[model samples]
Target: MPNHQLLNNMTHHDVKIITDYSTDYGDNISTVMTFPTEFGDIQKEYPIFFRKYPDSEEFQAVVMLGLFQNDNLFLQAGNWQANYIPGAITRGPFAIGFQDQSADGGSEKAPVVHIDMDHPRVNTEKGHPVFLEHGGNSPYLEHISNIFTHMMDGIEVGKTMFAAFKQFDLIEPIELEVTLEGDQVHKLHGNYTVSQTKLNELSAENLQALHRAGFLEAAYLVRSSLSNIQKLVNWQNQKMQQQVTSA
Candidate 1:
């Protein structure tokens, strides 16, 4: 239900985008789509996991933000508590679109920036402006462009990493059960993570290939991020205690 259009200074000269993090702006989510290229930074604050794409059978990496759907623990009083927000989450209301381009007597598609006019972040009078008064790209828009470029590159690297993971059977399903305050139980299922055992058993030639492709470090980053799951549990407990005290 998004009203997407090619971003142009002429048409959206006065538009501003909300850069603040809050649930009101749709930041309340349990996970955000992530990529292998970002696994190193993402692992520092979030637990990395894989889930099947809803429309496709392919697996995609995600940075878990909360234990339950629609619950983002990092959103505290309209601010993001983490040092690094996932690039996927930071690029709000903007996406890379392909447009036809004439080249060498033939037409090909080129990536372009598209903005969702209907998104909550889109406003005419508040937050960061997308264009300057002179109808040029604003500094915020330039930052978004860089983010989109990195996202595109990350997508390609992620494809290669996931393909290698599938080929080596290094993915394994994980089920997490947590007992919260008042003995409330929460269960998460159907998620996947890197299998260190399988990774260690890979042939030397395959290991070398992974190392050459830079997936070896990415695999370990994914493995290391699982430790943050306990951090998430601790956060939940603290939130629950605060709720009880306030009540």
Candidate 2:
């Protein structure tokens, strides 16, 4: 259970967070929600996919970090091997929370930073300080602020992008089957991807529409990112080999 509280310089003047990536900190996720805003950055390092919730017909973009649950292939020896860490992963224990505030004679939801006091990273001991000596944001806190901004922006853009993809009928269920070392077979289900055929088959007007909206390239990125799945297989092979040697 997360103990969330609005971040206050006075109340959390001594809050610090460990800047480490490891399973001990619950970084062993195989997949995470990504955004079209980050498609360029994410597609280069991780294979991107889409999935629809059981109760919702809307699609969401996701990036693959490993093959299955509890397996983060990028996590290695207390460090994340990937060059671009997902904002969700690096956000640590901070999140954007909304609070009602009066503005222009009307109340509205205002964005405020919230901290998870019970997160494993949170501490009063050594780590990146959340605030400066007295009562100001530290360099680390400033970086986290930037992350929330991009995350929020990404989410907004993603909604439009996914709507466009659905409008164009480009999202399709993917049948991904892989045979790893030692004849180990794995199949991924219930995930979606941008269909190259459908994307290419679109009318010129639709193509131009997607181009103007800046989503055509994002669709291509999702299609091209599948190549990274091979990299995952190779990494899994090496991990299995290491285990065999140590055994």
Candidate 3:
């Protein structure tokens, strides 16, 4: 369970967060959740795909980080090897929580930042400080706050986008088979992608509706991001070759 505490500069004065990537910090996943709000930047490097739960038909977007399980090709020596790190990865232990902070005897849900004290990144010494020595927001802290805002707003955006996807019957199952060096093949299942066929077959009125709602470009972005799957395959091949050379 996350021991979430409402972040206040007074109570948590010396909180520091380790921003390095490691398996212990839970960065070894092959995929990280992406948002429609981030599709443009995320699509530039990671291949965006959608997935549904075993019993749930609702689809969520994720960006592929590797060909196989727990293999994040973008992870290097304690650093991520990409210019644009997904907000989910960078947000670390921070979360946004809503509370009624109306001192005037009214009800208004206000978003406040919460910190998970149990997370490995939280430490008293050695890392990026959440607050400066004079009790002001550090650049890193400000950036994380912005990330939380984006992620929170993305919830409704994603919900409506996926609902539109279902309305247009644009999502279809996808099995990505990556052929690496020496005939090594990795098959990724339980993933879905936007169907170009379905997109093309949609009525002009439906296309206009999607376009007006700003979901059409997002759908195309998900499809266009598939091009980066080859990049993951190439990284896997390089890793395999390095293993062979070492052996």
lDDT of 3 by residue, 136-203 (tens): 98898999989988887787899999999999999999887878899977788889999999999999
lDDT of 1 by residue, 71-190 (tens): 999988668988899999999999999999988899899999999999999999898999999998999999999998888898988888889888889899988898988889999997
| lDDT of candidate 2 over 107-214, digit per residue (tens) | 899899999999999999978999999888999999999988999999999999998998999998998899887999999888899998999899999999999999
RMSD of each: 1.4, 1.1, 1.9
TM-score of 3: 0.92
Clashes of each: 0, 0, 0
In terms of lDDT, which candidate is stronger, 2 or 3? 2
lDDT measured at residue 33 in model 1 versus the true structure, 0 to 100: 91
Task: Evaluate residue 26 in candidate 3 and report its C-alpha lDDT on the 0 to 100 scale.
Answer: 82
What ranges in model 3 sit over 4 Å off? 102-106
lDDT of candidates 1 onward, in order:
0.91, 0.91, 0.90
**Model 1 residue 202 CA deviation in Å:** 2.5
In model 2, the number of clashes is 0
Q: Model 1: what TM-score?
A: 0.95
